[model samples]
Target: MNPGSEVVVTLRRATAPDARPAADVWLRSFAAALPTVVSPRSADEVRDYFRDVVVPLREIWVADAGDDGGGVVGLMVINGDELSQLYLEPDWRGRGLGDRFVELAKERSPVGLELWTFQVNKPAHRFYERHGFVAVEFTDGSGNEEREPDVRYVWEPKP
Candidate 1:
């Protein structure tokens, strides 16, 4: 394999050491993606939510850039059949990291996958759609903590 063409971004189960950085990724991407969507939680709260609730209950995966670059450029949170969260560093966008993460999610939940994103997050809509997810439902902000209008998307293996 050519050294220049080797893949830098790799995915693995997130460990305790990944908690802080993963939380940082989540917070940064969330804030950047949802500037117009009201969030009652601050950065600290977002971090704590990942460390306390998300990391404990879900399957957390991180995309590590290895020694040649800073580690953990992306993360995905999976809860059963749901792709609860997926985030990448601002610099990592458009670098195929999101598609790799979605492939990982598909590998984990081969039957189907589901996720919810704020209605204001247009980029997310585009990304998920590009990866074969379709909007299945929309809500008036009653089912989520942020109480923001949101949409649920689902993906299923092609028959």
Candidate 2:
């Protein structure tokens, strides 16, 4: 295997230890992807945020690679029948790792799934729609009263 040429991204269940690294990658990518996106707390704050939000969730998964160059490249946080978080590093966005991550999460989901996104995030809204998700509800983000209006989307995997 040649080094420094390509990344080998793979999907696996996220672990407690993965929370910090995942949060780091997620914070950087999310802020970059959505500049208007509310910035994350300081690094210390983000550490606890990930631990609380992602560490205890059994349904979440992380995209990692064996290369030392490879790390937690992407992540998804699903709960009950909803996918609450889906993010990938900006550099890794077009290679379809995100799609594969979605497919894997769907496979594990016994029932249909739902997610929320700000309507202003048109790219995400379109991606979910193109992947067969339907808008099911309107909501707010993390209790932010001033946030752009948001919509909930649901996807039913082929049985």
Candidate 3:
């Protein structure tokens, strides 16, 4: 059986009530997947970042698990043409939800979209590559919080 078969995810604009849950998903997924690539933050710190900063500053869309499970299973933060962040609950990985979010980002920014991921994050490289993103630049560990080498990817719609 397909992992995504039982779970139906629906995307929705995030509300105030979604801040905590969405932050929880982000914290857990980041802790599990990006220990070497991203800097660590306390759960409270992440919650505050979401509630006080991200929720107010960015256009965030959440992929909520429908009747199958419950609660937000994924999140995408889009700031203009940049997909600033995208994360899914560990349990929700390997489903089509990430692909859906990328499609939505493309739809939202038809001209192009750009994102950055740690160079060490091979899975992310593959995922973005499969979604039509191409690596455009590489940066040493100078600009980001984690101080890890990173790669920038951009997606342009086929004309």
Candidate 4:
């Protein structure tokens, strides 16, 4: 891939077969983006969660780069009004994929959407804010599995 060229990525619904790759994306992104936060679940556990829970019970989407010989580059999970997860491979960041994921989430839940990101994830704060999500609440870390302070963001379409 050239330095200035944009890689084509297709966003589509994740199937049961995508569980492993999606989970891999989540793990890599989390490790790179949130180095200070420790995940409670192991890598295998996370893959299992994706296989048994996320794929079956949530609205999951994957950014497929297979057309360009790249595998899954990103993953997003939405449940009801909550944007539960959004992760992109470390090398795939800043290419507008995250923006696309948020747009799709809004389309899926047009009324409003809510999400939580660790307070330390300033880049995420900026990204979500850019997408119209406002930080509405801050927590002291007790409510999350990672035990890291987090901030809640909400997005509602204008009237």
* Candidate No. with top lDDT: 4
Clashing pairs in 2: none
Question: For each candidate, what TM-score against the reference?
Answer: 0.90, 0.84, 0.92, 0.95
lDDT of each: 0.88, 0.79, 0.90, 0.95
Candidate 1: give the clashing pairs.
Answer: none
lDDT of 1 by residue, 37-155 (tens): 77788888877887887777679999998756678889998999999889998888999999999998999999999999999899999999999999999999999988999999999
Task: Find the 10 residues in a row with the least total lDDT in model 1.
Answer: 1-10
Ranking by TM-score: 4, 3, 1, 2
lDDT of 3 by residue, 81-105 (tens): 9999999999889988899999999
55 in model 4: Cα distance from truth in Å? 0.9
Deviating ranges (above 4 Å) for candidate 2: 1-5, 140-146
Q: What TM value does model 1 have?
A: 0.90
lDDT, candidate 4, 47-138, per-residue tens: 99999999888999999988563789999999999999999999999888999999999999999999999999999999999999999999
- Evaluate candidate 3 by giving its C-alpha RMSD to the native, one decimal: 2.7
Candidate 3: deviation at residue 21, Å? Answer: 0.8
Clashes of 2: 0
